[model samples]
Target: MRETRRQTFDEVDLLLDNARLRDELEPYRDESIDPSINRMPLHAENEYLASMLAWERAPALPIAEWFNPPLDLMPPDSLSDAQLSSLLNKTIERLFSKNIVLRCTDHLSDRELYMIVYRDILPCCEKMVDVPGKAIEWMCVEDTETWLRYYASAVERRRYQEERGMPLPAAETPPYRRQLPGQ
Candidate 1:
Protein backbone atom coordinates (compact mmCIF):
# COMPACT_ATOMS: atom_id res chain seq x y z
CA MET A 1 0.00 0.00 0.00
CA ARG A 2 2.79 2.45 0.93
CA GLU A 3 4.80 1.68 -2.25
CA THR A 4 1.73 2.06 -4.45
CA ARG A 5 0.83 5.35 -2.78
CA ARG A 6 4.40 6.59 -3.23
CA GLN A 7 4.24 5.79 -6.93
CA THR A 8 1.10 7.85 -7.40
CA PHE A 9 1.80 11.23 -8.99
CA ASP A 10 0.86 14.42 -7.18
CA GLU A 11 -1.11 16.70 -9.49
CA VAL A 12 0.46 19.98 -8.33
CA ASP A 13 4.00 18.60 -8.63
CA LEU A 14 3.20 17.21 -12.09
CA LEU A 15 2.09 20.60 -13.44
CA LEU A 16 5.04 22.41 -11.85
CA ASP A 17 7.56 19.93 -13.20
CA ASN A 18 6.01 19.94 -16.65
CA ALA A 19 6.14 23.75 -16.81
CA ARG A 20 9.78 23.77 -15.70
CA LEU A 21 10.64 21.09 -18.26
CA ARG A 22 9.03 23.06 -21.07
CA ASP A 23 11.06 26.16 -20.20
CA GLU A 24 14.34 24.28 -19.95
CA LEU A 25 13.73 22.44 -23.23
CA GLU A 26 12.59 25.49 -25.20
CA PRO A 27 16.09 26.42 -26.37
CA TYR A 28 16.80 22.85 -27.56
CA ARG A 29 13.38 22.11 -29.03
CA ASP A 30 13.34 19.42 -31.68
CA GLU A 31 10.07 18.32 -33.26
CA SER A 32 11.49 15.33 -35.12
CA ILE A 33 9.44 12.85 -33.07
CA ASP A 34 5.72 13.53 -32.67
CA PRO A 35 4.83 13.71 -28.97
CA SER A 36 1.18 12.81 -29.73
CA ILE A 37 2.21 9.23 -30.55
CA ASN A 38 2.79 8.60 -26.83
CA ARG A 39 -0.68 8.00 -25.39
CA MET A 40 0.30 7.84 -21.70
CA PRO A 41 -1.88 9.43 -19.00
CA LEU A 42 -1.12 12.97 -17.80
CA HIS A 43 1.41 12.09 -15.06
CA ALA A 44 3.28 9.57 -17.22
CA GLU A 45 3.28 11.97 -20.15
CA ASN A 46 4.97 14.55 -17.91
CA GLU A 47 7.59 11.97 -16.84
CA TYR A 48 8.34 11.14 -20.49
CA LEU A 49 8.74 14.83 -21.25
CA ALA A 50 10.95 15.31 -18.20
CA SER A 51 13.25 12.46 -19.33
CA MET A 52 13.55 14.02 -22.75
CA LEU A 53 14.44 17.32 -21.10
CA ALA A 54 17.05 15.62 -18.94
CA TRP A 55 18.83 14.24 -22.01
CA GLU A 56 18.52 17.52 -23.88
CA ARG A 57 20.00 19.62 -21.06
CA ALA A 58 22.59 17.07 -19.91
CA PRO A 59 26.09 18.56 -20.04
CA ALA A 60 28.68 16.85 -22.17
CA LEU A 61 31.29 16.17 -19.50
CA PRO A 62 33.99 13.57 -18.95
CA ILE A 63 32.91 10.51 -16.91
CA ALA A 64 35.31 11.59 -14.15
CA GLU A 65 33.26 14.72 -13.61
CA TRP A 66 30.14 12.63 -13.09
CA PHE A 67 31.33 11.38 -9.67
CA ASN A 68 31.69 13.37 -6.45
CA PRO A 69 35.29 12.19 -6.09
CA PRO A 70 36.80 12.55 -9.54
CA LEU A 71 38.02 9.29 -11.11
CA ASP A 72 41.42 10.32 -12.32
CA LEU A 73 43.88 7.90 -13.96
CA MET A 74 47.52 7.91 -15.02
CA PRO A 75 48.15 8.25 -18.73
CA PRO A 76 47.83 4.80 -20.34
CA ASP A 77 51.03 5.06 -22.35
CA SER A 78 53.05 5.96 -19.26
CA LEU A 79 52.17 2.73 -17.43
CA SER A 80 54.02 -0.60 -17.68
CA ASP A 81 52.01 -3.80 -18.35
CA ALA A 82 51.71 -4.72 -14.63
CA GLN A 83 50.78 -1.18 -13.58
CA LEU A 84 48.20 -1.02 -16.35
CA SER A 85 46.67 -4.31 -15.18
CA SER A 86 46.28 -2.96 -11.63
CA LEU A 87 44.88 0.37 -12.82
CA LEU A 88 42.50 -1.33 -15.22
CA ASN A 89 41.00 -3.41 -12.40
CA LYS A 90 40.57 -0.34 -10.22
CA THR A 91 39.13 1.62 -13.15
CA ILE A 92 36.54 -1.10 -13.92
CA GLU A 93 35.39 -1.06 -10.28
CA ARG A 94 35.12 2.74 -10.28
CA LEU A 95 33.12 2.73 -13.53
CA PHE A 96 30.78 0.10 -12.05
CA SER A 97 30.17 2.38 -9.07
CA LYS A 98 28.59 4.85 -11.51
CA ASN A 99 26.66 2.08 -13.34
CA ILE A 100 28.99 2.10 -16.34
CA VAL A 101 29.57 -1.51 -17.36
CA LEU A 102 32.13 -2.51 -19.98
CA ARG A 103 30.96 -5.15 -22.42
CA CYS A 104 32.70 -7.13 -25.17
CA THR A 105 36.06 -6.55 -23.47
CA ASP A 106 37.43 -10.09 -23.22
CA HIS A 107 39.07 -9.81 -26.63
CA LEU A 108 41.50 -7.04 -25.62
CA SER A 109 44.65 -7.06 -23.49
CA ASP A 110 44.78 -5.10 -20.21
CA ARG A 111 46.76 -2.28 -21.82
CA GLU A 112 44.40 -2.15 -24.78
CA LEU A 113 41.31 -1.99 -22.53
CA TYR A 114 42.90 0.68 -20.32
CA MET A 115 43.88 2.69 -23.41
CA ILE A 116 40.30 2.50 -24.66
CA VAL A 117 39.00 3.82 -21.32
CA TYR A 118 41.61 6.56 -21.15
CA ARG A 119 41.45 7.58 -24.81
CA ASP A 120 37.88 6.80 -25.83
CA ILE A 121 35.53 6.17 -22.89
CA LEU A 122 36.61 8.73 -20.26
CA PRO A 123 36.79 11.66 -22.68
CA CYS A 124 33.53 10.68 -24.41
CA CYS A 125 30.51 12.89 -23.75
CA GLU A 126 27.47 11.00 -22.45
CA LYS A 127 24.39 11.55 -20.33
CA MET A 128 25.37 11.00 -16.68
CA VAL A 129 22.05 9.60 -15.54
CA ASP A 130 21.61 8.84 -11.83
CA VAL A 131 19.16 6.00 -12.24
CA PRO A 132 19.94 3.40 -9.55
CA GLY A 133 20.73 -0.13 -10.70
CA LYS A 134 20.24 0.79 -14.37
CA ALA A 135 23.64 0.24 -15.95
CA ILE A 136 24.84 1.71 -19.24
CA GLU A 137 26.88 -1.04 -20.89
CA TRP A 138 29.68 0.42 -23.02
CA MET A 139 30.60 -1.74 -25.96
CA CYS A 140 34.39 -1.61 -25.79
CA VAL A 141 35.34 -2.80 -29.25
CA GLU A 142 34.39 -2.02 -32.80
CA ASP A 143 30.88 -3.52 -32.83
CA THR A 144 30.82 -5.99 -35.64
CA GLU A 145 33.80 -8.30 -35.11
CA THR A 146 33.69 -8.97 -31.34
CA TRP A 147 29.91 -8.90 -31.24
CA LEU A 148 29.60 -11.42 -34.08
CA ARG A 149 32.29 -13.75 -32.71
CA TYR A 150 31.55 -13.71 -28.96
CA TYR A 151 28.44 -11.79 -27.84
CA ALA A 152 25.71 -12.45 -30.39
CA SER A 153 23.21 -15.16 -29.54
CA ALA A 154 21.99 -17.67 -32.13
CA VAL A 155 18.73 -15.80 -32.69
CA GLU A 156 20.53 -12.48 -33.10
CA ARG A 157 23.03 -14.07 -35.48
CA ARG A 158 20.20 -15.47 -37.58
CA ARG A 159 18.45 -12.09 -37.54
CA TYR A 160 21.65 -10.37 -38.70
CA GLN A 161 22.11 -12.95 -41.50
CA GLU A 162 18.50 -12.56 -42.59
CA GLU A 163 18.63 -8.76 -42.39
CA ARG A 164 22.07 -8.03 -43.86
CA GLY A 165 22.38 -11.14 -46.04
CA MET A 166 26.03 -11.48 -44.97
CA PRO A 167 27.96 -14.52 -43.79
CA LEU A 168 28.17 -14.78 -39.98
CA PRO A 169 31.55 -15.04 -38.30
CA ALA A 170 32.12 -18.34 -36.51
CA ALA A 171 31.69 -18.17 -32.74
CA GLU A 172 34.91 -18.62 -30.77
CA THR A 173 36.03 -18.32 -27.15
CA PRO A 174 37.03 -14.73 -26.44
CA PRO A 175 40.85 -14.90 -26.11
CA TYR A 176 41.32 -13.04 -22.81
CA ARG A 177 38.22 -14.11 -20.87
CA ARG A 178 38.18 -13.45 -17.12
CA GLN A 179 35.62 -12.38 -14.51
CA LEU A 180 35.25 -8.67 -13.86
CA PRO A 181 33.26 -6.90 -11.13
CA GLY A 182 29.50 -7.31 -11.31
CA GLN A 183 27.13 -4.42 -12.09
Candidate 2:
Protein backbone atom coordinates (compact mmCIF):
# COMPACT_ATOMS: atom_id res chain seq x y z
CA MET A 1 0.00 0.00 0.00
CA ARG A 2 1.07 3.54 -0.70
CA GLU A 3 2.30 5.54 2.24
CA THR A 4 0.53 8.87 2.51
CA ARG A 5 0.52 11.98 4.70
CA ARG A 6 -2.82 13.30 3.65
CA GLN A 7 -5.06 14.86 6.31
CA THR A 8 -8.36 16.70 6.14
CA PHE A 9 -9.20 19.84 8.10
CA ASP A 10 -11.18 17.96 10.72
CA GLU A 11 -8.22 15.69 11.24
CA VAL A 12 -6.39 18.47 13.01
CA ASP A 13 -8.87 18.33 15.85
CA LEU A 14 -8.60 14.57 15.96
CA LEU A 15 -4.84 14.78 16.03
CA LEU A 16 -4.88 17.14 18.95
CA ASP A 17 -7.42 15.02 20.77
CA ASN A 18 -5.34 11.94 20.17
CA ALA A 19 -2.23 13.65 21.50
CA ARG A 20 -4.08 14.68 24.60
CA LEU A 21 -5.41 11.21 25.07
CA ARG A 22 -1.94 9.80 24.66
CA ASP A 23 -0.66 12.07 27.38
CA GLU A 24 -3.44 11.02 29.66
CA LEU A 25 -2.89 7.39 28.88
CA GLU A 26 0.88 7.41 29.13
CA PRO A 27 1.12 6.81 32.88
CA TYR A 28 -0.81 3.60 32.49
CA ARG A 29 0.98 2.13 29.49
CA ASP A 30 2.71 -1.20 29.94
CA GLU A 31 5.41 -1.17 32.62
CA SER A 32 6.24 -4.83 33.11
CA ILE A 33 9.25 -6.35 31.40
CA ASP A 34 10.16 -9.97 30.84
CA PRO A 35 13.67 -10.52 32.15
CA SER A 36 14.10 -13.95 30.73
CA ILE A 37 14.97 -13.68 27.05
CA ASN A 38 15.15 -17.45 26.93
CA ARG A 39 11.43 -17.87 27.54
CA MET A 40 9.14 -17.96 24.51
CA PRO A 41 9.07 -14.52 23.01
CA LEU A 42 6.21 -12.34 24.15
CA HIS A 43 4.93 -12.04 20.64
CA ALA A 44 1.57 -10.35 20.39
CA GLU A 45 -0.96 -12.95 19.30
CA ASN A 46 -0.79 -13.71 15.56
CA GLU A 47 -4.42 -12.88 14.78
CA TYR A 48 -3.94 -9.38 16.18
CA LEU A 49 -0.73 -9.03 14.19
CA ALA A 50 -2.45 -10.41 11.11
CA SER A 51 -5.18 -7.79 11.38
CA MET A 52 -2.56 -5.06 11.40
CA LEU A 53 -0.76 -6.67 8.46
CA ALA A 54 -4.03 -6.76 6.56
CA TRP A 55 -4.58 -3.07 7.17
CA GLU A 56 -1.26 -2.28 5.51
CA ARG A 57 -2.45 -4.06 2.38
CA ALA A 58 -5.96 -2.64 2.28
CA PRO A 59 -6.58 0.52 0.26
CA ALA A 60 -6.72 3.63 2.41
CA LEU A 61 -10.40 4.33 2.49
CA PRO A 62 -11.87 7.41 4.12
CA ILE A 63 -11.64 6.80 7.91
CA ALA A 64 -15.03 8.49 8.34
CA GLU A 65 -17.14 5.44 7.74
CA TRP A 66 -15.05 3.57 10.22
CA PHE A 67 -15.45 6.45 12.61
CA ASN A 68 -18.75 8.24 13.08
CA PRO A 69 -20.86 6.53 10.48
CA PRO A 70 -24.24 7.93 9.48
CA LEU A 71 -26.95 7.09 11.93
CA ASP A 72 -29.89 7.45 9.58
CA LEU A 73 -29.97 3.72 9.31
CA MET A 74 -30.38 3.43 13.07
CA PRO A 75 -32.92 6.25 13.51
CA PRO A 76 -31.73 7.60 16.87
CA ASP A 77 -30.55 11.10 15.97
CA SER A 78 -33.32 12.71 17.97
CA LEU A 79 -32.14 11.44 21.34
CA SER A 80 -31.08 13.85 24.12
CA ASP A 81 -27.39 14.73 24.23
CA ALA A 82 -26.84 12.83 27.48
CA GLN A 83 -28.64 9.82 26.17
CA LEU A 84 -26.85 9.95 22.89
CA SER A 85 -23.52 10.31 24.59
CA SER A 86 -24.23 7.35 26.80
CA LEU A 87 -25.28 5.23 23.88
CA LEU A 88 -22.32 6.32 21.82
CA ASN A 89 -19.97 5.54 24.69
CA LYS A 90 -21.41 2.08 24.95
CA THR A 91 -21.08 1.60 21.23
CA ILE A 92 -17.53 2.80 21.34
CA GLU A 93 -16.66 0.50 24.21
CA ARG A 94 -18.27 -2.46 22.54
CA LEU A 95 -16.42 -1.67 19.32
CA PHE A 96 -13.10 -2.12 21.13
CA SER A 97 -12.18 1.54 21.16
CA LYS A 98 -8.68 2.61 22.12
CA ASN A 99 -8.33 3.62 25.74
CA ILE A 100 -5.89 3.89 28.64
CA VAL A 101 -5.20 0.17 28.51
CA LEU A 102 -4.08 0.36 24.91
CA ARG A 103 -1.64 3.26 25.15
CA CYS A 104 2.09 2.49 25.07
CA THR A 105 3.88 3.01 28.32
CA ASP A 106 7.64 3.53 28.42
CA HIS A 107 7.96 -0.16 29.23
CA LEU A 108 7.22 -1.53 25.78
CA SER A 109 9.46 -0.75 22.84
CA ASP A 110 8.00 1.34 20.06
CA ARG A 111 7.72 -1.68 17.81
CA GLU A 112 5.81 -3.56 20.48
CA LEU A 113 3.59 -0.57 21.08
CA TYR A 114 3.05 -0.19 17.36
CA MET A 115 1.96 -3.78 17.07
CA ILE A 116 -0.38 -3.39 20.01
CA VAL A 117 -1.83 -0.05 18.97
CA TYR A 118 -2.24 -0.58 15.28
CA ARG A 119 -3.30 -4.18 15.61
CA ASP A 120 -5.36 -4.19 18.77
CA ILE A 121 -6.15 -0.51 19.21
CA LEU A 122 -6.54 1.05 15.77
CA PRO A 123 -9.00 -1.50 14.51
CA CYS A 124 -11.06 -0.94 17.63
CA CYS A 125 -10.69 2.81 17.26
CA GLU A 126 -12.15 2.48 13.80
CA LYS A 127 -15.58 2.10 15.31
CA MET A 128 -15.01 4.41 18.26
CA VAL A 129 -12.69 7.39 17.82
CA ASP A 130 -13.92 10.10 15.52
CA VAL A 131 -10.58 10.81 13.96
CA PRO A 132 -9.87 14.34 12.76
CA GLY A 133 -8.57 14.76 9.22
CA LYS A 134 -5.18 15.96 10.39
CA ALA A 135 -4.67 12.86 12.56
CA ILE A 136 -4.72 10.76 9.40
CA GLU A 137 -1.44 12.37 8.43
CA TRP A 138 -0.11 11.73 11.92
CA MET A 139 -1.22 8.13 11.69
CA CYS A 140 0.63 7.84 8.41
CA VAL A 141 3.76 9.15 10.05
CA GLU A 142 3.42 6.72 12.95
CA ASP A 143 2.79 3.85 10.56
CA THR A 144 5.84 4.67 8.49
CA GLU A 145 8.07 4.92 11.51
CA THR A 146 6.87 1.54 12.75
CA TRP A 147 7.48 -0.09 9.39
CA LEU A 148 11.02 1.32 9.18
CA ARG A 149 11.89 -0.04 12.63
CA TYR A 150 10.54 -3.46 11.74
CA TYR A 151 12.43 -3.41 8.44
CA ALA A 152 15.65 -2.27 10.05
CA SER A 153 15.58 -5.00 12.68
CA ALA A 154 14.88 -7.69 10.11
CA VAL A 155 17.75 -6.48 7.96
CA GLU A 156 20.07 -6.39 10.94
CA ARG A 157 19.15 -9.93 11.93
CA ARG A 158 19.88 -11.26 8.45
CA ARG A 159 23.21 -9.46 8.40
CA TYR A 160 24.21 -10.90 11.78
CA GLN A 161 23.23 -14.41 10.71
CA GLU A 162 25.21 -14.11 7.45
CA GLU A 163 28.32 -12.90 9.28
CA ARG A 164 28.10 -15.48 12.07
CA GLY A 165 27.47 -18.40 9.69
CA MET A 166 24.65 -19.70 11.87
CA PRO A 167 21.01 -18.99 12.46
CA LEU A 168 20.87 -16.24 15.04
CA PRO A 169 21.61 -17.59 18.51
CA ALA A 170 20.02 -15.94 21.53
CA ALA A 171 22.97 -13.61 21.92
CA GLU A 172 22.09 -12.19 18.50
CA THR A 173 18.90 -10.73 19.90
CA PRO A 174 18.09 -7.57 17.96
CA PRO A 175 18.21 -4.47 20.09
CA TYR A 176 14.75 -3.00 20.50
CA ARG A 177 14.66 0.71 19.91
CA ARG A 178 11.44 2.49 20.59
CA GLN A 179 10.25 4.32 17.48
CA LEU A 180 9.25 7.81 18.56
CA PRO A 181 5.55 8.36 18.24
CA GLY A 182 4.57 10.17 15.01
CA GLN A 183 8.19 10.52 13.98
lDDT of candidates 1 onward, in order: 0.80, 0.38
lDDT of 1 at 142: 92
- Candidate 1 lDDT over residue span 51-124, tens digit each: 67666766778887877777778998898889999989988988988788998888999988998998888887
RMSD of each: 3.9, 21.6
Per-prediction TM-score, please?
A: 0.75, 0.21
Please give the clash total of every predicted structure, in order: 0, 5
Residues forming the 10-long window of minimal summed lDDT in candidate 1: 32-41
In model 2, where is the ten-residue run with the lowest total lDDT? 131-140
Q: How much does candidate 2 score in TM-score?
A: 0.21
Q: Model 2, range 1-183, lDDT digits (tens) per residue?
A: 223433444455555644564455445445332234224322322222233333444454322234455221122445555565455445434323322222222344444434443444444323232322212322222432333333336677667667777655332222443333233
